[model samples]
Target: MKELNSIPIENIYYMLCYSWDKLDYISRNKIGIEESMDIQNLLCRILVDEVDILIKKGIKKNYKELNESSSVVKGKINFKESIKYKSTKQCKVNHSYDELNENIIINIVIKTTLINLIKIEDLSISNRNKVKRLIKYFNFIDTILLNKKIFKNISFNKMNREYKFIINICELIFDNLLINKNDNSAEFYNFIEDERKMAYLFESFIRNFYKKELKGAKVYREDIYWELTGEFVEFLPKMQTDISLEYNDKKYLIDAKYYKKSLVENYGSKKLISGNLYQIFSYLKNNESKSKKDEFSTGILLYPRVDKTLDLEYSMDKHNINIYTVNLNSKWNEISKRLISLIK
Candidate 1:
């Protein structure tokens, strides 16, 4: 994969927006795209702009259950607590009620992310000031101890759909940031060096890009079942494809890989990664066996260009397997064209 430091900051921004399905927002806002900035500054700019837009539209409010002692009865009355506290003497009652407020989970997440961003020394002074300014708008929102588990409890519906893009940005920021417990400081690490996180972003970017740009073809991730007749087949793990495109009765199963080196050295000779090849091959054969129609199936192992370019093709058992690389260091327009041309 192209090193994060070498890739243009604007290209990384575009990839992130595409992965989050916020291309429309980014295009309309056009925030800080022309500036010569690093990844931290670019992300901070986008976050500030998006949060400013959201504030203008009014932050979302959800009904949260509140439990307290009050003179007025609401929702459900807790008689035991009321009696225990001797409410009759004070003329107050204990009750649990739902109140509409801005202290929802999504808002809290955004607030926490902004606070953390301000602590990162890598961000430009201007970007840090912008983040500080945006923090004032979230005064009503509560801040919580942010963790990966907190994200799992969040769900989006029609009412909160607008928050999805912002929340995704917050999640990305959280993933790349490391917190210090001693002094409560945060450090922003270069995401390119983090293989696991970059792998996910690369995969999502490819899938969403294909879904948006490709026409006359249905794009989706598919689960391929093994073509076996044994009763103990439950022991086998499920085979899932990263990107599956179907057009003209043909299926293209793509496996997107993000690695520091596209080719590995073996005995002083560069060679294709054996494990990746085997995995894609298994996907193609099993998927082909399950189909009853005479449809042609192809497997593609797509990776980001690293040191050199690679475009190799192979055919086995009437199935075609292609290994291609997309250079992220190129211009955005060229990169987009190259990606679309791969399956075409």
Candidate 2:
């Protein structure tokens, strides 16, 4: 709701984060981003521009007493407001930063903003030539790029139709790369962008460690659909769908969560905001049914694997609802391998 020019960087972060949640799986997963790279960049740029533009308007103010700073930004930032974050560990790391916290709000806002601005064209064949490399692989790059490139590339748009093949190739590479999070730039943001990123990371774990030389059986990822019927009927409106591992016709759901290890054993009812186990129970009840017999659906409430050491299980009906605790303090890739072995 708050335009880039008229709001604080945090507001923009909130917007991008909220918008990132609404995106489809492909858009959310293709890029390893807190707000999914492109939105992160674009929103960052928009906010920065607003800050700059507002500066030109001769707006000047400081909220150091209240600890605010956007007013100090040339345009859209409140550098003073971010004073609270000055002592935060992040401020001490980047050399591009200062100890004074002059632009704590503006600088972080800029850094992350730039981090999100990777257009297909930017991530394309020209600047980095990643496009040419990507073309030799996946085919549906264009569609994925269309979702991230909220801007236009005059050169890409003007290219001869024949180059469409190369363009398509670039798109594919970008999408595939996004779906994979091995890039250094991806390390710029935290992994809490949205449920889909969490979901993508979960599947990536399966492919990276479980798939081995056999990586083509991920059809269940795409086969999952939002149906108004079946055991998942009541939640059809809100349960944000479920993750499935479909081999032939057998589909299993992998519902993920980003929970703190200290608080991982309680039901997600009002009493327990930190721990949420029944959330998976609800999904299991809604997603797994008898008729889906050939395809069994079990919900996995994947907490960001941590050393909290509290693993759990629920005896709901006859379903062996597994409430597994992943140790995020170390790594998250093992959840899949662990699940595969546990179920095997």
TM-score of each: 0.92, 0.36
Model 1 C-alpha lDDT per residue in residues 1-344, reported as the tens digit of each score: 33644777777888888888877976698575754776667777878888998999999998999999878888899988899668448877889999998998899999999999988877788888889998998998889888999887889999988888888778878988888878877788778667887899889999999888888888899998887879899999999999998866778899999888879999999999999999998887777756742135888999889888898999887788999999988899999999888877
Clashes of each: 0, 29
Off by over 4 Å in 2: 1-236, 246-251, 261-276, 288-297, 328-336
Task: Give the winner by lDDT.
Answer: 1
Question: Each candidate: what lDDT?
Answer: 0.85, 0.38
Q: List RMSD in Å for every model shown.
A: 2.2, 21.0
Number of the top-ranking candidate, with TM-score as the measure: 1
Model 1: per-residue Cα lDDT at residue 126: 85
lDDT of 2 by residue, 1-344 (tens): 01111223332332233333321322333332342234334333333333343335533222332222332333334445455557663342111222232222222222222233343233422322322332222222122223335222413334223223223323322333342245434322323444455445444543333333224434233223333447756565565433445544444455555433325244553222323455555555655443563224555555444444445655556455565654432222343345565435
The window of 10 residues in a row where model 1 has the poorest summed lDDT is 287-296
